[model samples]
Target: MASRDLVTGKIFSLQTIVGILGNFSVLYFYLFLHYTRCKLRSTDCNLKNLTVANLLVIFSKGVPKMMAGFGLKDFINDFGCKFFFYVHRVGRDVSIGTTCLLSVFQAIAISPLNSRWAELKVKAHKYIATSNIFCWILNMMLNIILPLYVTDKRNNTNFTQKTDYGYCYVMEDGTVTMKIYAALILCRDGFSLVLIVSASSFTVFILHRHKQQVRYIHRNNLSPRSSPESTATQSILVLLCTFVSLWTLSSIFLICLTVLNNLSLWLRNTSALINACFPTVSPYILINYDSRVPRVCFA
Candidate 1:
C-alpha cells in the first residue's frame, strides 16, 4: 500500500510539474511579446487575460501539489493553506469569467450588421473592464464563505475514513445542506457550460456563413485577402473550441464527484487529474495556436 501510494504521488507530481511549467512558459511568452511591442489589439488583450488567469491557477494549485508530493506537507502551514486555497478558488473563478467573456466577444465580433446583438459590439470596449471587476467581486463574495466551512484539523483515528486528506469544512448537519451545496455548484457550472456551448455554437455558425460568403465572392472573381478578418475569425473560433472542451470536461467531473459521492478513490483521483490536466495543457495550446509565436522556436 505504501509503495502504491508513493508511485501514484510521484506520477501526479510529474504531471503537476509539466502543467505548471507549460502554463508559466505561455504566460511569459505573451508578456514578453506584449512588452516588446508596447501595444495589444483587443483580441490580444483577451488572450493575455486568459493566460494570466491560467498562470495564477498553476501557481496556487499546481505548484503546491508538486511540493506536497516531494514530502513538503508541513511546508504549507495554516496560513499557506488558507492563502493558497483562496487564490486557487479566485483564479479558477476568474478563468471561468474570462472564458465566458471571450465567447461573448467572439459572438459579437461575428454578428451580422443587421443582427440585434451587432449594437453590443459598439459598447463592449467600455464594459470589458467593468465586467471583469464585477466577476472578481461576485466570486470573492461567493467563496468568502468557504473558509468558514473548512479547517486544517486532522480527522479522528477511529472515524470511518472517507477522504484521507483533511481540510476545512463545516460538519454536515444532514444530507440537506450537502444536497444544497451540490445543487448550487451544479447550477453555477451548468450556467457557465451553457454559455460556452451557446457562444461556440454562434461563432461556428457565423464562421460557416462567412466562409460561404467568401466562396461566393471568389466565384465572382473578388479578392479574399482584402481584409485579415478571416484569420482573426479563425483564431477566435480555435480559442473558443479549446476553452469549451477543457472547461466542460473539468466541470463535468467536478459535478459528478460532488453529487455522486460514491466514486472510488481511484476514480476520484482520475477525475481530479483530468480537471487539473486541462489548465496545464491550456497554455501550450495557446502558444501553439497563436500566429505570433514561432512554432519551431517554442518546440
Candidate 2:
C-alpha cells in the first residue's frame, strides 16, 4: 500500500468514527428528550431527520472511501457499488433538502408578528413532518438512476470515460439522457441553495434587529444572558454557513470530476473528505448550542 493510501485511510477512519459517534449522540439525546416527556420544540423533528440523513451520508460514503483508502481494491461487486452509491447520493441530496428546510423553518420561527412570514410561523411546525417525508421521497426518486451509472471498478476496466472513485467506477456514456439527469440534479440543488440562502439572510436580519432592540433597552450594558431564540438563531446560522461552505467546495470537486474522465486519486479523496465535513462537524455544533444536552448529560 502506498503511503498516501495509508494516510488517507487513517483520516477516513478517524472522520467516520467521530462522525458516527457525534450523530448517534445527538439522536440519542433527542430520543431521550422525547420519551422522557420533556418539552420539545417544533423543529426537533427536523433536527432528528437531519441527524439521520447525516448518518446515512457518513456511513454510505465515508465507509466506502475508508475501505478503498485502506487499499481494498476490487473488494466490492457491481451490486455493492450500485447500492452504496445509490444510498450515498440519496442521503446526500436529502441532507441538503433537510438542511434547507431546517433553515427556512427556523427563519419562520423567529419572524415578527407583522412580517409576511408570520402567517407561515403558525402552520410551519405542523408541516415539518410532512415536509421531511416529501424531501425523502423526492430525493430518492431523483437519485434512483445513480446506481445505473455505477459499477465495481474491476468490472469496467476497459471503459475510456469513467470516474474511478477508488472502490467503484462511475461509467459515463456521455448520453443526452445522462446530461439531462445531471442538469436536473443541479437544478434541484440550486433551488435548495436559494431557499437556504434566503432563509438564512432573513434570520440574520431578525437577529440584528433583536440585538438592536436589546441595546436600546439596556444601553448601559448588554444582557448578560442570551435569549433562547438568539442562541438558537446564532447556532443555526453557524450550521448553515458550514454546510454551504463545505457543500460548495464538494460541488466544485464533483463538477471537476464529472467533466474530467481521467482518474485523480487526490481529487477523489479530497472531495470525499470535504463531503464528510458537515456530517462530522454538525452534530457537535448542535450539541454545543443545545442547552438541554448539558442537563441530560448530568442527569
Candidate 3:
C-alpha cells in the first residue's frame, strides 16, 4: 500500500511540475514581447490576464499536489493548511472568472458593427484591466471566510479523520459545517460555470458567423486569404473552445462526485489532473498559434 501511494504521488508531482514550468515559460515570452514591442491591445490584455490566472492556478493547486507527493503534507501546519486551501479555492475561481471574461471580451470584439455592444470595442482596453483587478479582489474577499470553516484534525476522532490521505474535511457528528462548505463550493462553481458557458457559446456563435463571411468573401474573389486579425481571432476561438470543453467535462465529474458521493480516490485525482492539464496545454497552443511570434523572433 505504501509503495502504491508513493508511485501515485510521484506521477502527480511530476505532472504538476511540467504543467507549471510550461505555463511560466509561455507567460514569460508573452510578457516580454508585450513590453518590448507589442502594444497592450484588448487581445493582448486578455491573454495577459489569462496567463496571470494560470500562474495562480499553478502555484495554489499544482505546488500543493507536488508537496503532497513528496510526503511534505506535514509542512502545512494548522495555519498553513487553512491558508493553502484558501488560496487554492480562490485561485481556481479567479482562473474561471478570467477565462470567462476573455471569452466575453473576444466575442464582443468580433460582434457585428451594429450590435448592441459594438461600441464597447473602442473603450474596452481602458477598462478591461480594471475589471480584471476587480475580479481578483472580489474573489479574494469572498473566499476570505473559508478558513473560519476549515481546520486540520490530527486523527479520526468522531468527525475528524487522518487516513493515508493528505488533507480532508471530516464531518463532525451532526455538525453542518461540511455540508455548508460543500454548498458554498457548489454555488461558486455553478456561478462561474454559467458565465463560462454563456461566454463560450457567444464566442462560438460569433466565430461561426465570421467564418461564414470570410468564406463568402473568398467565393466572390473579394479576398484571397484570411486577414491576420481574423486568423488570430480564430486561434483564440479554438483555444477558448478547448478550455471550455475540458473544464466542462471536469466540472461535470466534480458535480457527480459531490452530489452522488460515490467517487473513488482515483476518479477524484483524475479529475484534478484533467483540470490542471488544460492550463498546461493552453500555453503551448498560444505560442504555436501566435502569428506575431515569427515576426518578433526575426525582428
Candidate No. with top TM-score: 2
What TM-score, over all chains together, does every model reach? Answer: 0.80, 0.96, 0.83
Could you give candidate 1's per-residue lDDT for residues 168-245 as a string of tens digits? Answer: 222333456556755765677678778877988888898888787678778887775635455656666676677677
**Candidate 2 residues 91-120, lDDT tens each?**
888899999999999999999989887788
Record all residue pairs in model 1 with backbone atoms less than 3 Å apart, i.e. clashing: 149-169, 149-170, 150-168, 150-169, 151-168
- C-alpha positional error of residue 258 in candidate 1 after TM-score superposition, expressed in Å: 2.7
Ranking by lDDT: 2, 3, 1
The lDDT values for all models are 0.65, 0.89, 0.69
Q: Per-residue alpha-carbon lDDT of model 3 for 42-74, expressed as tens digits?
A: 777767777777766667666666666566655
Report the C-alpha displacement of residue 198, candidate 1, in angstroms: 1.1
TM-score of 3: 0.83
Better of 2 and 3 by lDDT: 2
Sort by TM-score, best first: what order? Answer: 2, 3, 1
